[model samples]
Target: MWVSSSAFEALLDSGACACPVRLGQRLDPSGEYVRRYVPELARVPGDYIYEPWKAPIEVQERANCIIGRDYPAPVVNHLAAAQRNRNAMKELREMLQKAPPHCCPSSDDEIRQFMWLSEEGQATATVGSN
Candidate 1:
């Protein structure tokens, strides 16, 4: 429960989840929380709030905020972070498989053959297929 809540909170804080303020896309297109924390983008229009980097010169002038000048660019690229995390997880999975069986807790009912990758690309396991 703690992990789930923390993950949910992370998504919310990162603006990766849909905003409850509006329907459709949950992405914080309006940059409500972002603008609140990042005051440099407070005057940015709704269209470019989430992505101030895309704002044009005129828009920047009108808003009186310059990207990289008034506010620093986004510290982390979500796409790159996601790819890195995926690679790390894959490595961990490989390491787990190579570790000695005695290192992990054992279970009865043929636990060794309980897991398999499904055709749809899901990492799945079956306790009892029936």
Candidate 2:
């Protein structure tokens, strides 16, 4: 669900699964106006949000779009977007690092035997494998 998880849950809560405005890949509120002009489709290497305003004029010119005069203002303020991404990534990293490592009670030999159809099959396969 990406960032739309909350909105999806809201729709389910309201029993409005078929809500018309609940469009997937929905157009920006500003509509095709954004697409017709330059869209910073993605963030550059280090930056999280595509904030055209902060980009150098030379960089914008190289990209073949003028800043302010050419591209529309970012839908949300860049500072806010940057903060949101930073916090989200931080939380996610913490969650992942806290996840438990998995281990089985069986040893490597036991695992190999368990995977085989029978002990005879395991012995035969294990002989060839080794």
Candidate 3:
């Protein structure tokens, strides 16, 4: 419940996951979490271990974790994707705000059902209908 709520909040706020390295740095400054869970990054220097893709080719070689070969490069650029999602969410929020009250959920139960239907890719035309 907590995790789901947090993720939903993050999506509403930034349309992106909190930066893993930043969170890790706050929780475990030594990068212990990455070293333990991501063996490919075990030998990377603490400065670059959290964001291995930022590490230079020489550093990657030394760490024995080539960004594209050892560990796949990111398929989507996170920053760009986040910005795109944020814009789309902003537009959605604007559209929703412009909609009539009857088109919006007015109760917690209705809100939950609406969100569930949205997640399931189902039509939500009846969400707040009388």
TM-score of each: 0.51, 0.27, 0.62
Residues 79-113, candidate 1, lDDT per residue (tens digit)? Answer: 67656655665665568668764332144333433
- Give the per-residue Cα lDDT of candidate 1 at 116: 39
Clashing pairs counted in every model: 1, 0, 0
Candidates 2 and 3, the one with greater lDDT = 3
lDDT of 1: 0.59
Best TM-score among the predictions, by candidate number: 3
Across 4-80, the per-residue lDDT of candidate 3 in tens digits comes to 12222333444344555577888988888789998888998988876789999999999999999998787787678
- Single out the weakest 10-residue window by summed lDDT for candidate 1: 1-10
lDDT by residue (tens digit), candidate 2, 64-109: 5565666665566545655675566567556856877434435546
* lDDT values, one for every candidate: 0.59, 0.46, 0.70
- Model 3, total clashes: 0
- Least accurate 10 contiguous residues by lDDT in model 2: 13-22
Positional deviation of residue 83's Cα in model 1 after best superposition, in angstroms: 1.0
